[model samples]
Target: MATFFGEVVSVYSRAVEEDEEEEEEGEEDAEIRREVQKQREVHLNWRSEIAESIESSSDKTFQCSDLVIAVGQNASGFLSAFVLSTGNWDVVGTVTLWNERTKGPSQVTNTQLPEESRCVLYRQAACPSVVICQCTYYVAEDQLFQWTEKVLGSIQRRGLRVLVLSDCSVAEYKTSECITASPSPFLRTLKTSEYRDALRCPLMEQPNILTGLPAAVLSHCQVHRIPAVVYQCYSDVACPDSLTMEAYRPALSCLSSKLGKVDYNPSTEVLRKVVRVSEAQSNLYT
Candidate 1:
Protein backbone atom coordinates (compact mmCIF):
# COMPACT_ATOMS: atom_id res chain seq x y z
CA MET A 1 0.00 0.00 0.00
CA ALA A 2 1.02 3.64 -0.45
CA THR A 3 2.32 5.72 2.44
CA PHE A 4 2.43 9.38 3.35
CA PHE A 5 5.09 11.20 5.36
CA GLY A 6 6.17 7.91 6.92
CA GLU A 7 2.59 7.05 7.84
CA VAL A 8 0.12 4.83 6.08
CA VAL A 9 -1.43 7.26 3.64
CA SER A 10 -4.63 5.41 2.95
CA VAL A 11 -5.57 5.00 6.58
CA TYR A 12 -4.55 8.45 7.73
CA SER A 13 -6.37 10.20 4.92
CA ARG A 14 -9.57 8.27 5.57
CA ALA A 15 -9.42 9.06 9.24
CA VAL A 16 -9.09 12.76 8.61
CA GLU A 17 -11.95 12.74 6.14
CA GLU A 18 -14.08 10.65 8.46
CA ASP A 19 -13.35 13.04 11.24
CA GLU A 20 -14.54 15.90 9.09
CA GLU A 21 -17.65 13.99 8.04
CA GLU A 22 -18.37 13.03 11.62
CA GLU A 23 -18.04 16.64 12.58
CA GLU A 24 -20.78 17.46 10.10
CA GLU A 25 -22.90 14.55 11.21
CA GLY A 26 -23.44 15.85 14.71
CA GLU A 27 -22.56 19.50 15.09
CA GLU A 28 -23.04 19.42 18.82
CA ASP A 29 -20.85 16.40 19.55
CA ALA A 30 -18.94 17.63 22.57
CA GLU A 31 -16.36 14.86 22.56
CA ILE A 32 -15.40 15.37 18.95
CA ARG A 33 -15.36 19.11 19.39
CA ARG A 34 -13.12 18.76 22.40
CA GLU A 35 -10.70 16.59 20.49
CA VAL A 36 -10.61 19.00 17.59
CA GLN A 37 -10.31 21.92 19.94
CA LYS A 38 -7.29 20.28 21.52
CA GLN A 39 -5.57 19.82 18.17
CA ARG A 40 -6.30 23.41 17.18
CA GLU A 41 -4.89 24.52 20.47
CA VAL A 42 -1.57 22.86 19.68
CA HIS A 43 -1.49 24.26 16.16
CA LEU A 44 -2.46 27.77 17.22
CA ASN A 45 -0.15 27.77 20.17
CA TRP A 46 2.78 27.07 17.90
CA ARG A 47 1.64 29.90 15.70
CA SER A 48 1.41 32.18 18.70
CA GLU A 49 5.04 31.66 19.58
CA ILE A 50 6.06 32.60 16.04
CA ALA A 51 3.90 35.73 16.12
CA GLU A 52 5.43 36.90 19.36
CA SER A 53 8.83 37.34 17.74
CA ILE A 54 7.32 39.03 14.67
CA GLU A 55 5.46 41.57 16.80
CA SER A 56 8.50 42.53 18.82
CA SER A 57 10.51 43.63 15.73
CA SER A 58 12.09 47.09 15.97
CA ASP A 59 12.19 48.28 12.35
CA LYS A 60 9.04 49.05 10.34
CA THR A 61 9.83 47.70 6.87
CA PHE A 62 9.41 44.41 4.99
CA GLN A 63 10.93 42.32 2.18
CA CYS A 64 9.85 39.98 -0.61
CA SER A 65 11.72 36.71 -1.11
CA ASP A 66 11.30 34.12 -3.88
CA LEU A 67 13.46 31.02 -4.51
CA VAL A 68 14.38 28.74 -7.45
CA ILE A 69 12.66 30.16 -10.54
CA ALA A 70 13.44 27.25 -12.85
CA VAL A 71 15.85 24.47 -13.87
CA GLY A 72 19.59 24.89 -14.68
CA GLN A 73 22.06 25.97 -12.02
CA ASN A 74 22.40 29.54 -13.28
CA ALA A 75 18.74 30.61 -13.24
CA SER A 76 17.95 27.92 -10.66
CA GLY A 77 18.56 30.32 -7.82
CA PHE A 78 16.08 33.00 -8.85
CA LEU A 79 13.56 32.16 -6.17
CA SER A 80 16.38 32.00 -3.68
CA ALA A 81 17.45 35.49 -4.69
CA PHE A 82 13.93 36.80 -4.24
CA VAL A 83 13.65 35.30 -0.78
CA LEU A 84 16.92 36.93 0.15
CA SER A 85 15.91 40.46 -0.87
CA THR A 86 15.35 42.52 2.25
CA GLY A 87 14.43 46.12 1.70
CA ASN A 88 11.63 48.60 2.31
CA TRP A 89 8.41 46.78 3.05
CA ASP A 90 6.52 49.12 0.74
CA VAL A 91 8.56 47.83 -2.21
CA VAL A 92 9.01 44.13 -1.71
CA GLY A 93 12.16 42.75 -3.36
CA THR A 94 11.86 41.47 -6.92
CA VAL A 95 13.29 38.03 -7.87
CA THR A 96 13.89 37.08 -11.53
CA LEU A 97 13.95 33.41 -12.53
CA TRP A 98 14.67 31.73 -15.87
CA ASN A 99 16.39 28.50 -16.83
CA GLU A 100 19.98 28.39 -18.12
CA ARG A 101 20.19 25.07 -19.94
CA THR A 102 23.97 24.85 -20.04
CA LYS A 103 26.88 27.27 -19.76
CA GLY A 104 26.43 30.96 -18.93
CA PRO A 105 23.44 32.71 -20.46
CA SER A 106 25.62 35.81 -20.65
CA GLN A 107 28.72 35.69 -22.79
CA VAL A 108 30.69 37.70 -20.25
CA THR A 109 29.70 35.26 -17.48
CA ASN A 110 31.98 32.27 -16.80
CA THR A 111 30.08 29.07 -16.04
CA GLN A 112 33.16 27.18 -14.93
CA LEU A 113 34.53 27.68 -11.43
CA PRO A 114 37.80 26.67 -9.80
CA GLU A 115 37.55 23.29 -8.07
CA GLU A 116 39.00 24.84 -4.89
CA SER A 117 36.48 27.67 -4.71
CA ARG A 118 34.08 28.02 -1.83
CA CYS A 119 31.64 30.71 -0.83
CA VAL A 120 29.78 31.80 2.28
CA LEU A 121 26.04 32.60 2.20
CA TYR A 122 25.47 35.28 4.83
CA ARG A 123 26.93 38.38 6.47
CA GLN A 124 25.88 40.31 9.58
CA ALA A 125 24.79 43.77 8.50
CA ALA A 126 22.01 46.37 8.57
CA CYS A 127 20.49 44.82 5.48
CA PRO A 128 18.33 41.77 5.95
CA SER A 129 20.38 38.59 5.66
CA VAL A 130 19.88 36.51 2.54
CA VAL A 131 19.80 32.71 2.34
CA ILE A 132 19.14 30.64 -0.78
CA CYS A 133 18.58 26.87 -1.06
CA GLN A 134 17.01 24.71 -3.77
CA CYS A 135 15.97 21.08 -4.24
CA THR A 136 13.41 18.97 -6.05
CA TYR A 137 10.90 16.52 -4.55
CA TYR A 138 12.35 13.30 -5.98
CA VAL A 139 15.94 14.31 -5.30
CA ALA A 140 15.84 14.94 -1.54
CA GLU A 141 12.58 13.89 0.05
CA ASP A 142 14.05 12.02 2.99
CA GLN A 143 16.23 14.73 4.48
CA LEU A 144 13.89 17.51 3.41
CA PHE A 145 12.26 17.93 6.79
CA GLN A 146 15.36 17.59 8.94
CA TRP A 147 17.56 19.86 6.83
CA THR A 148 15.07 22.72 6.74
CA GLU A 149 14.26 22.20 10.38
CA LYS A 150 17.85 23.13 11.19
CA VAL A 151 18.05 26.05 8.75
CA LEU A 152 14.80 27.66 9.87
CA GLY A 153 15.60 27.00 13.49
CA SER A 154 18.88 28.87 13.27
CA ILE A 155 17.38 31.81 11.35
CA GLN A 156 14.78 32.24 14.09
CA ARG A 157 17.28 31.98 16.95
CA ARG A 158 19.16 34.95 15.45
CA GLY A 159 16.13 37.21 16.11
CA LEU A 160 16.12 38.82 12.63
CA ARG A 161 12.71 38.89 11.03
CA VAL A 162 12.53 36.41 8.14
CA LEU A 163 10.39 36.00 5.03
CA VAL A 164 10.78 32.51 3.55
CA LEU A 165 9.20 31.29 0.31
CA SER A 166 10.31 27.88 -0.89
CA ASP A 167 10.06 27.34 -4.66
CA CYS A 168 9.22 23.65 -4.31
CA SER A 169 7.30 21.23 -2.13
CA VAL A 170 4.81 19.66 -4.51
CA ALA A 171 5.15 16.24 -2.95
CA GLU A 172 4.32 17.72 0.41
CA TYR A 173 1.35 19.43 -1.18
CA LYS A 174 0.14 16.03 -2.39
CA THR A 175 0.80 14.05 0.77
CA SER A 176 -0.77 16.58 3.13
CA GLU A 177 -4.18 16.08 1.49
CA CYS A 178 -4.23 12.91 -0.64
CA ILE A 179 -4.34 9.37 0.60
CA THR A 180 -2.11 6.83 -1.08
CA ALA A 181 -2.69 3.10 -1.04
CA SER A 182 0.87 1.74 -1.00
CA PRO A 183 4.34 3.08 -0.60
CA SER A 184 6.37 0.56 -2.56
CA PRO A 185 5.59 -1.34 -5.68
CA PHE A 186 7.22 -4.24 -3.85
CA LEU A 187 4.02 -4.63 -1.87
CA ARG A 188 2.18 -5.69 -4.97
CA THR A 189 0.29 -8.37 -3.08
CA LEU A 190 -1.15 -5.95 -0.60
CA LYS A 191 -4.64 -4.60 -1.20
CA THR A 192 -4.88 -0.86 -1.71
CA SER A 193 -7.82 1.50 -1.35
CA GLU A 194 -8.64 5.16 -1.08
CA TYR A 195 -7.62 6.79 2.16
CA ARG A 196 -11.32 7.12 2.84
CA ASP A 197 -11.52 3.35 2.87
CA ALA A 198 -8.72 2.60 5.25
CA LEU A 199 -8.10 2.85 9.02
CA ARG A 200 -5.17 2.48 11.39
CA CYS A 201 -2.88 2.10 8.41
CA PRO A 202 0.45 0.44 8.96
CA LEU A 203 3.73 2.29 9.32
CA MET A 204 5.69 3.00 6.15
CA GLU A 205 9.07 1.35 5.70
CA GLN A 206 10.65 3.36 2.87
CA PRO A 207 12.12 6.81 2.92
CA ASN A 208 9.45 9.48 2.76
CA ILE A 209 8.14 9.71 -0.80
CA LEU A 210 7.43 13.40 -0.67
CA THR A 211 9.97 15.61 0.93
CA GLY A 212 8.60 15.88 4.46
CA LEU A 213 9.76 19.44 4.21
CA PRO A 214 7.17 22.19 3.65
CA ALA A 215 5.24 21.91 6.93
CA ALA A 216 8.52 21.69 8.75
CA VAL A 217 9.76 24.69 6.77
CA LEU A 218 6.70 26.68 7.80
CA SER A 219 7.06 25.53 11.35
CA HIS A 220 10.67 26.68 11.60
CA CYS A 221 10.33 30.18 10.10
CA GLN A 222 6.96 30.61 11.71
CA VAL A 223 8.61 29.99 15.05
CA HIS A 224 9.96 33.52 14.87
CA ARG A 225 6.54 34.45 13.66
CA ILE A 226 8.07 37.06 11.37
CA PRO A 227 5.57 38.83 9.17
CA ALA A 228 6.07 36.51 6.20
CA VAL A 229 4.31 35.02 3.23
CA VAL A 230 5.29 32.84 0.26
CA TYR A 231 4.42 33.27 -3.42
CA GLN A 232 4.90 29.90 -5.13
CA CYS A 233 4.41 29.35 -8.84
CA TYR A 234 3.89 25.84 -10.14
CA SER A 235 5.43 25.29 -13.58
CA ASP A 236 3.78 21.92 -14.01
CA VAL A 237 0.55 19.99 -13.34
CA ALA A 238 2.27 18.30 -10.40
CA CYS A 239 0.93 20.96 -8.08
CA PRO A 240 -0.53 19.23 -5.07
CA ASP A 241 -3.15 20.31 -2.56
CA SER A 242 -2.40 23.99 -2.32
CA LEU A 243 -3.97 25.68 0.64
CA THR A 244 -6.82 27.86 -0.55
CA MET A 245 -6.26 31.60 -0.74
CA GLU A 246 -8.98 31.87 1.93
CA ALA A 247 -7.15 29.49 4.24
CA TYR A 248 -3.86 31.33 3.72
CA ARG A 249 -5.33 34.67 4.75
CA PRO A 250 -6.19 33.45 8.21
CA ALA A 251 -2.65 32.18 8.71
CA LEU A 252 -1.40 35.62 7.75
CA SER A 253 -3.75 37.13 10.29
CA CYS A 254 -2.19 34.93 12.91
CA LEU A 255 1.28 35.98 11.69
CA SER A 256 0.35 39.66 11.52
CA SER A 257 -0.77 39.59 15.13
CA LYS A 258 2.82 38.65 15.93
CA LEU A 259 4.11 41.68 13.99
CA GLY A 260 2.73 44.09 16.60
CA LYS A 261 -0.65 44.73 14.95
CA VAL A 262 0.92 46.00 11.71
CA ASP A 263 -1.17 45.42 8.58
CA TYR A 264 0.81 42.40 7.36
CA ASN A 265 -1.89 41.07 5.07
CA PRO A 266 -1.89 41.33 1.27
CA SER A 267 -5.32 42.89 0.87
CA THR A 268 -4.57 45.87 3.13
CA GLU A 269 -3.18 49.08 1.68
CA VAL A 270 0.12 49.88 3.41
CA LEU A 271 0.03 53.50 2.18
CA ARG A 272 -3.02 54.17 4.29
CA LYS A 273 -2.11 51.82 7.14
CA VAL A 274 1.33 53.47 7.45
CA VAL A 275 2.70 50.41 9.23
CA ARG A 276 5.67 49.02 7.37
CA VAL A 277 6.42 45.31 7.84
CA SER A 278 10.02 45.09 6.51
CA GLU A 279 11.67 47.72 8.68
CA ALA A 280 9.61 46.32 11.47
CA GLN A 281 11.17 42.88 10.93
CA SER A 282 14.85 43.90 10.90
CA ASN A 283 14.67 46.05 14.01
CA LEU A 284 13.26 43.12 15.90
CA TYR A 285 16.84 41.88 16.00
CA THR A 286 19.54 43.47 18.17
Candidate 2:
Protein backbone atom coordinates (compact mmCIF):
# COMPACT_ATOMS: atom_id res chain seq x y z
CA MET A 1 0.00 0.00 0.00
CA ALA A 2 1.23 3.49 -0.80
CA THR A 3 1.78 5.84 2.08
CA PHE A 4 0.40 9.37 1.92
CA PHE A 5 3.72 10.66 0.64
CA GLY A 6 3.85 7.91 -1.93
CA GLU A 7 0.39 8.81 -3.13
CA VAL A 8 1.63 12.35 -3.63
CA VAL A 9 4.26 11.11 -6.02
CA SER A 10 1.74 9.09 -7.97
CA VAL A 11 -0.64 11.99 -8.23
CA TYR A 12 2.11 14.37 -9.25
CA SER A 13 3.27 12.02 -11.97
CA ARG A 14 -0.25 11.68 -13.30
CA ALA A 15 -0.81 15.40 -13.15
CA VAL A 16 2.29 16.05 -15.23
CA GLU A 17 1.63 13.50 -17.91
CA GLU A 18 0.55 14.63 -21.40
CA ASP A 19 -1.34 11.50 -22.30
CA GLU A 20 -4.68 11.60 -24.12
CA GLU A 21 -6.33 9.54 -21.41
CA GLU A 22 -5.80 12.36 -18.96
CA GLU A 23 -7.51 14.81 -21.28
CA GLU A 24 -10.50 12.49 -21.60
CA GLU A 25 -11.02 12.76 -17.83
CA GLY A 26 -11.64 16.51 -17.64
CA GLU A 27 -13.77 16.13 -14.54
CA GLU A 28 -11.04 14.19 -12.79
CA ASP A 29 -8.46 16.75 -13.83
CA ALA A 30 -10.56 19.56 -12.42
CA GLU A 31 -10.96 17.68 -9.16
CA ILE A 32 -7.26 17.11 -8.85
CA ARG A 33 -6.59 20.74 -9.67
CA ARG A 34 -9.02 21.80 -6.96
CA GLU A 35 -7.29 19.62 -4.43
CA VAL A 36 -3.95 21.09 -5.41
CA GLN A 37 -5.45 24.56 -5.10
CA LYS A 38 -6.61 23.85 -1.57
CA GLN A 39 -3.14 22.73 -0.65
CA ARG A 40 -1.69 25.90 -2.14
CA GLU A 41 -4.04 28.09 -0.13
CA VAL A 42 -2.92 26.36 3.03
CA HIS A 43 0.69 26.92 2.15
CA LEU A 44 0.13 30.58 1.29
CA ASN A 45 -1.62 31.15 4.58
CA TRP A 46 1.30 29.51 6.33
CA ARG A 47 3.87 31.56 4.44
CA SER A 48 1.99 34.77 5.18
CA GLU A 49 3.01 34.32 8.79
CA ILE A 50 6.64 34.48 7.75
CA ALA A 51 5.95 37.47 5.54
CA GLU A 52 4.20 39.17 8.42
CA SER A 53 7.12 38.49 10.69
CA ILE A 54 9.43 39.99 8.12
CA GLU A 55 7.22 43.07 7.89
CA SER A 56 6.84 43.37 11.65
CA SER A 57 10.59 43.16 12.10
CA SER A 58 11.48 45.91 9.65
CA ASP A 59 11.23 48.63 12.29
CA LYS A 60 13.22 47.24 15.22
CA THR A 61 16.45 45.68 16.36
CA PHE A 62 16.75 42.62 18.58
CA GLN A 63 18.34 42.69 22.05
CA CYS A 64 17.78 39.17 23.36
CA SER A 65 19.93 36.40 21.90
CA ASP A 66 22.83 34.33 23.16
CA LEU A 67 22.37 30.76 22.01
CA VAL A 68 21.78 29.05 18.70
CA ILE A 69 21.30 25.32 18.15
CA ALA A 70 22.56 24.42 14.70
CA VAL A 71 21.79 21.02 13.17
CA GLY A 72 23.52 20.00 9.97
CA GLN A 73 22.96 17.27 7.44
CA ASN A 74 25.28 16.15 4.61
CA ALA A 75 27.50 19.16 5.00
CA SER A 76 27.34 19.20 8.77
CA GLY A 77 30.96 20.04 9.30
CA PHE A 78 30.93 22.89 6.80
CA LEU A 79 27.68 24.34 8.07
CA SER A 80 28.47 23.82 11.74
CA ALA A 81 31.91 25.30 11.34
CA PHE A 82 30.48 28.34 9.57
CA VAL A 83 27.94 28.96 12.32
CA LEU A 84 30.41 28.45 15.15
CA SER A 85 33.05 30.56 13.41
CA THR A 86 30.76 33.54 13.13
CA GLY A 87 30.48 33.70 16.94
CA ASN A 88 30.39 31.58 20.09
CA TRP A 89 26.83 30.43 19.40
CA ASP A 90 26.40 26.89 20.72
CA VAL A 91 26.27 24.30 17.97
CA VAL A 92 24.26 21.43 19.43
CA GLY A 93 25.34 18.96 16.69
CA THR A 94 23.50 16.89 14.12
CA VAL A 95 20.16 15.17 14.12
CA THR A 96 19.90 11.35 14.43
CA LEU A 97 18.06 9.98 11.40
CA TRP A 98 16.52 6.52 11.34
CA ASN A 99 14.77 4.38 8.70
CA GLU A 100 17.02 5.28 5.82
CA ARG A 101 16.88 2.71 2.99
CA THR A 102 15.66 0.55 5.86
CA LYS A 103 19.26 0.38 7.09
CA GLY A 104 18.09 1.06 10.60
CA PRO A 105 19.53 4.34 11.90
CA SER A 106 22.19 6.85 10.94
CA GLN A 107 23.37 10.03 12.58
CA VAL A 108 23.68 13.25 10.59
CA THR A 109 27.35 13.64 11.29
CA ASN A 110 30.20 15.88 10.30
CA THR A 111 31.96 14.96 7.05
CA GLN A 112 34.82 13.64 9.19
CA LEU A 113 32.65 11.11 10.96
CA PRO A 114 31.75 7.67 9.67
CA GLU A 115 28.74 7.27 7.39
CA GLU A 116 26.81 6.20 10.42
CA SER A 117 27.54 6.80 14.09
CA ARG A 118 26.03 5.29 17.20
CA CYS A 119 26.30 8.29 19.46
CA VAL A 120 25.00 11.71 18.54
CA LEU A 121 25.60 14.51 21.06
CA TYR A 122 23.86 17.84 21.58
CA ARG A 123 24.58 20.68 24.03
CA GLN A 124 22.06 22.52 26.15
CA ALA A 125 22.26 26.32 26.32
CA ALA A 126 20.27 28.74 28.43
CA CYS A 127 19.47 31.97 26.60
CA PRO A 128 17.32 33.27 23.78
CA SER A 129 17.73 30.60 21.09
CA VAL A 130 17.10 29.77 17.46
CA VAL A 131 17.42 26.37 15.77
CA ILE A 132 19.04 26.11 12.36
CA CYS A 133 18.45 23.01 10.27
CA GLN A 134 20.98 23.09 7.46
CA CYS A 135 20.24 20.97 4.42
CA THR A 136 18.17 18.70 6.62
CA TYR A 137 15.45 17.83 4.11
CA TYR A 138 16.36 14.17 4.34
CA VAL A 139 15.17 14.10 7.92
CA ALA A 140 11.87 12.40 8.68
CA GLU A 141 9.03 14.92 8.79
CA ASP A 142 7.27 13.28 11.72
CA GLN A 143 10.47 13.26 13.74
CA LEU A 144 11.22 16.88 12.87
CA PHE A 145 7.67 17.86 13.78
CA GLN A 146 7.81 16.09 17.10
CA TRP A 147 11.18 17.61 17.94
CA THR A 148 9.84 21.09 17.11
CA GLU A 149 6.77 20.46 19.21
CA LYS A 150 8.87 19.44 22.17
CA VAL A 151 11.80 21.82 21.89
CA LEU A 152 10.25 24.96 20.42
CA GLY A 153 6.89 24.32 22.01
CA SER A 154 8.45 23.81 25.44
CA ILE A 155 10.17 27.17 25.42
CA GLN A 156 8.19 29.20 27.93
CA ARG A 157 9.28 32.33 26.14
CA ARG A 158 8.18 33.23 22.62
CA GLY A 159 11.43 33.78 20.71
CA LEU A 160 12.32 30.40 19.20
CA ARG A 161 12.82 30.58 15.44
CA VAL A 162 13.63 27.70 13.11
CA LEU A 163 15.81 28.50 10.13
CA VAL A 164 16.09 25.95 7.34
CA LEU A 165 19.01 26.20 4.94
CA SER A 166 19.09 24.28 1.69
CA ASP A 167 21.55 23.94 -1.16
CA CYS A 168 20.25 22.99 -4.57
CA SER A 169 21.69 22.15 -7.94
CA VAL A 170 19.93 22.77 -11.23
CA ALA A 171 18.45 19.30 -11.28
CA GLU A 172 17.12 19.65 -7.78
CA TYR A 173 15.38 22.94 -8.50
CA LYS A 174 11.64 23.32 -8.24
CA THR A 175 9.61 26.47 -8.45
CA SER A 176 8.83 27.89 -5.00
CA GLU A 177 5.22 27.65 -6.06
CA CYS A 178 5.37 23.88 -6.52
CA ILE A 179 7.19 23.14 -3.27
CA THR A 180 5.33 25.31 -0.78
CA ALA A 181 2.94 22.46 0.01
CA SER A 182 4.97 19.31 -0.59
CA PRO A 183 7.27 17.34 1.68
CA SER A 184 10.59 17.24 -0.19
CA PRO A 185 10.55 20.71 -1.73
CA PHE A 186 14.28 20.73 -2.18
CA LEU A 187 14.41 17.56 -4.28
CA ARG A 188 12.78 16.23 -7.40
CA THR A 189 12.70 12.77 -8.94
CA LEU A 190 15.55 12.21 -11.33
CA LYS A 191 14.86 11.94 -15.01
CA THR A 192 16.33 9.01 -16.93
CA SER A 193 18.64 11.13 -19.08
CA GLU A 194 19.63 13.36 -16.21
CA TYR A 195 20.50 10.31 -14.13
CA ARG A 196 22.64 9.02 -17.01
CA ASP A 197 24.37 12.37 -17.27
CA ALA A 198 25.31 12.37 -13.59
CA LEU A 199 26.15 8.70 -13.23
CA ARG A 200 27.44 6.49 -15.99
CA CYS A 201 25.75 3.52 -14.37
CA PRO A 202 22.36 2.23 -15.52
CA LEU A 203 19.41 4.39 -14.52
CA MET A 204 17.78 1.31 -13.03
CA GLU A 205 20.49 1.27 -10.38
CA GLN A 206 19.15 4.51 -8.88
CA PRO A 207 16.07 4.84 -6.76
CA ASN A 208 13.07 6.54 -8.37
CA ILE A 209 12.42 8.89 -5.51
CA LEU A 210 11.63 12.52 -4.74
CA THR A 211 11.76 14.22 -1.36
CA GLY A 212 9.33 16.73 0.17
CA LEU A 213 10.87 16.73 3.63
CA PRO A 214 11.62 20.45 3.69
CA ALA A 215 8.06 21.47 2.94
CA ALA A 216 6.72 18.87 5.33
CA VAL A 217 8.85 20.15 8.18
CA LEU A 218 8.00 23.75 7.38
CA SER A 219 4.32 22.94 7.21
CA HIS A 220 4.58 21.30 10.57
CA CYS A 221 6.08 24.50 11.96
CA GLN A 222 3.28 26.52 10.42
CA VAL A 223 0.67 24.21 11.93
CA HIS A 224 2.19 24.74 15.36
CA ARG A 225 2.45 28.52 14.86
CA ILE A 226 6.20 28.46 15.07
CA PRO A 227 8.21 31.23 13.40
CA ALA A 228 10.40 29.68 10.70
CA VAL A 229 12.46 30.72 7.69
CA VAL A 230 14.02 28.98 4.69
CA TYR A 231 16.76 29.97 2.30
CA GLN A 232 18.55 28.15 -0.52
CA CYS A 233 22.04 28.32 -1.95
CA TYR A 234 23.00 27.25 -5.43
CA SER A 235 26.08 25.13 -6.03
CA ASP A 236 27.40 21.96 -7.63
CA VAL A 237 25.93 19.65 -5.01
CA ALA A 238 23.27 18.76 -7.54
CA CYS A 239 24.63 20.57 -10.59
CA PRO A 240 27.46 22.79 -11.68
CA ASP A 241 26.28 26.27 -10.79
CA SER A 242 27.85 29.48 -9.57
CA LEU A 243 27.81 29.68 -5.79
CA THR A 244 26.50 32.56 -3.73
CA MET A 245 25.36 33.14 -0.17
CA GLU A 246 22.69 35.68 -1.08
CA ALA A 247 19.94 33.32 -0.05
CA TYR A 248 20.92 33.77 3.56
CA ARG A 249 19.89 37.41 3.81
CA PRO A 250 16.17 36.95 4.23
CA ALA A 251 16.59 34.21 6.80
CA LEU A 252 19.06 36.16 8.89
CA SER A 253 16.91 39.24 8.80
CA CYS A 254 13.84 37.26 9.77
CA LEU A 255 15.67 35.93 12.81
CA SER A 256 16.76 39.40 13.80
CA SER A 257 13.30 40.87 13.40
CA LYS A 258 11.55 38.20 15.43
CA LEU A 259 14.02 38.16 18.32
CA GLY A 260 12.45 41.16 20.05
CA LYS A 261 9.07 39.53 20.10
CA VAL A 262 10.28 36.59 22.17
CA ASP A 263 8.78 36.64 25.63
CA TYR A 264 10.65 35.67 28.80
CA ASN A 265 9.42 32.96 31.10
CA PRO A 266 10.76 33.61 34.58
CA SER A 267 9.78 30.14 35.70
CA THR A 268 11.66 28.27 32.94
CA GLU A 269 14.49 30.80 33.13
CA VAL A 270 15.82 29.92 29.69
CA LEU A 271 16.49 33.63 29.34
CA ARG A 272 19.15 33.56 32.03
CA LYS A 273 22.72 34.35 31.04
CA VAL A 274 24.04 31.44 33.08
CA VAL A 275 22.73 27.92 33.26
CA ARG A 276 23.58 25.35 35.91
CA VAL A 277 26.56 23.23 34.86
CA SER A 278 24.47 20.12 35.30
CA GLU A 279 21.69 21.50 33.10
CA ALA A 280 23.99 23.03 30.52
CA GLN A 281 26.12 19.95 29.95
CA SER A 282 23.42 17.33 29.82
CA ASN A 283 21.95 16.29 26.46
CA LEU A 284 19.07 14.80 28.40
CA TYR A 285 17.94 18.17 29.73
CA THR A 286 15.62 18.74 26.77
Best by TM-score: 2
Clashing residue pairs in all predictions, respectively, total: 34, 5
Best by lDDT: 2
Worst 10 residues of 2 by lDDT: 39-48
Q: How many backbone clashes does candidate 2 have?
A: 5
Model 2, 1-286: lDDT tens per residue?
A: 3776665346666656846566769879899988644332210011223334434664422222222322323223323322322333433333344433223333322333333232122222333344443333244444545444433433332443444444545345434454344333222212211111132112211332223444444565566555544344333343211112322333343433434332211222321211232224333556
lDDT of 1 by residue, 111-171 (tens): 2222211111221133333333332212134334444543343343433333332333223
Off by over 4 Å in 2: 1-81, 89-94, 101-128, 133-137, 140-157, 174-211, 234-236, 239-250, 254-286
Whole-model lDDT per candidate: 0.29, 0.35
